[model samples]
Target: MTTIVFLHAHPDDESTQTSGAMARASAEGDRVVVVYATNGDHGDAPEDLADGETVVHRRRVEAEASAQATGTQQIVWLGYADSGMSGWDQNDAEDALHGADVDVVAKQLAAVLDEEDADVLVGYDWHGNYGHPDHVKVHHVAHRAAELAARRPRLLESTMNRTRMAADRQARLDRGEKVDWDPSAPMDDGNPLGSTEEEISWEVDVSPYLEQRRAAVRAHESQGDTAWMRSMPDEEFATMFGAEYYIEPGRTEPIEKGWPFRPPD
Candidate 1:
């Protein structure tokens, strides 16, 4: 069985982005681990937070639940403080994820990859899909970790298919159907969200694992009100989220409807 490591910037990120792939991999008998870069302390505070729970505490609990629902074998926390956004006050905090030294964080993650003897390492896109500061840091640390890994594992950046999203949205609008997400809209870093189809190197179909994905999403109870994907109709959700895209550095083109991990024979 292959061991796959997924390094993400926060807790819920795994659910919204890579949970399907993680669930599918685990079900195929491969080992799957999710390493969160931060505790997600900056998310929306739930109004009904139990007596004395902190955002970090609640998020950690939720993340663990999501991991379990997704069939992830293990979840590791780097324990860095959350970096709110590009200009938030949290960005200046000494322990914020954005302030962590990329090399230091990479070394730590490299240790995990080495210990797990990971065959594949999943990370965020170079621009972190929309250029969130912490996510951009994840991209940086992931590359450095790859360099430090004892046996450098294969690298895949979780990303979205911008081309497909644009087409689907336009088609839906033409048919008088409303689209929930708009890729063309301005993002946090003033960049186009996600990678174009040509930039993606693989598309893993996780339709069969949508249930796992759904459970993972629901596990983040605090984010219940903002979980846009879960708000979509079942058919729409299946169509839009059935395929998860990835970009392998230096790959020229995508493998049509391919599986990202191929076990060693």
Candidate 2:
């Protein structure tokens, strides 16, 4: 069976970004592993956190639940602290993922790749899809790790479909619905959210696994940011997340419906 490793920035990121792929992989009898760069210690703290319960502790539990929901066979963490957002003071912390040495982190991740004998390594696109500092670091680390692995795995950078996202936003506007973030506008690191259609290599259809994806997202209940996602209607959720995007660097072909571990027809 093929082994696919998904590298993510935080506890809930896998849910929104790659959980569908993970669920699909698991259903196909492949091994799925998720490696989180941080414990998400800097994310929103839940009001229900018990006295003395650390944000890291709460998020760790949630991450485990998320992995279970996604049918992930194993979970690994690099043990770094969250770097907050791009300009936040936490970015300067010694243990912050954003500040960690890329080579050092890459070696650690490469060790996992070697151990898993991974067939494919999935990470975020450059600019980290929306330019979150830790996410960007993850992109760098994932690439470097693949280079360092004893057996190099096919690397796929996960991303959002900017073209489709914009179309969806325009559709919402046409419906007279309020829309917040614009895909075409500058985001955290000054780049627009996701990559344009021409830049993306694959549009992975994950509609068949939306239920597991939804469950994985719900598992991160401690993260207030995902609340709206969890509350979305099934059809709306499918419309928004049924397809995951990726950029396979060096692939000079039209975008197609397929995933990292499989070949496109």
Candidate 3:
């Protein structure tokens, strides 16, 4: 079976970003593995976190549930602490993922790639999609690890269709609807969120795995209702997340209509 490894920034990131694709891969009898770059020790604390319960521990538990629900064959952790947002002091923490040496982290991740013999390695887009510090680091680490590994796999970078996001927002605004977050707002590196549609290579239709995706998302209970995601109505959730997008390595060929597996040959 073909093996694909998805490298993500945090615990819940897998469910929100790559679970649909991972589930589809596993369903097709391919082995799916998820590698998280950090333990998410610095995320927002769930209101119900038991007294003295560490955020790291809580997120790990949630990630495990997410992995199982997503049909992931294995999950690996990089064991780094969360590097909060761009300006947070946590970014300076000794163990913060953002502060870690890229070479050291890349070497560690390369070991996993070598161990799994992955056929494909999925990473974040250049700006980490939304410019989160840890997310950006995952992008660097993933690509660097692939380079470090003697045997390289096809590397794909996960990204949002910023073109679609803007279009959807404008359509909503025209309909007298109010959107929550502003995509054009200054993100982590002062770049716009996601990439333009023309830059996107894969617009994966994950609709068939919607149920699995939902279950995987729900598994991050600590981030579920407490986070902004679970508050969405079922239909809205499906509509917004039914597709995943990616920028294929070395190929700027415009995206055509197709699912995840049909990457540019």
Clashing pairs in 2: none
* Model 2 residue 261 distance off true place after TM-score fit, in angstroms: 1.5
lDDT of 1 at 173: 95
Better of 1 and 3 by TM-score: 1
Model 2 local distance difference test score: 0.92
- Ranked by lDDT from best down, the candidates are 2, 1, 3
lDDT string for model 1 (1-265, tens) is 9999999999899988898999999999999999999999888899978898888899999988988998898989999988987889999899999989999999999999999999999999988998899999999999999999998889889998889889988998999987687997767888889988888899999999988888888898797644776676889778877889999887776556788675322
Summed backbone clashes in each candidate are 0, 0, 0
Q: Using TM-score as the measure, what is the rank order of every candidate, best first?
A: 2, 1, 3
lDDT of 3 by residue, 1-265 (tens): 7889899998888888888898889888999889999998777678888988888888888888887887898989889998988999999999999999999999999999899887788999998998899999999998899899867878889998888888888899999998887777777789989888988888888888988888888878776433566667878888878999988778868896565552224
Model 2: per-residue Cα lDDT over 1-265, one tens digit each:
8899999999999999999999999999999999999989988988998999998999889888988888899999999999999899999999999999999999999999999998899999999998999999999999999999998998999999999999989999999999997999999989999999999999899999999999999999988888999999988999998999999988989898866675222
Error of 1 at 19 (Å): 0.8
Give residue 22's error in model 1 in angstroms.
Answer: 0.3
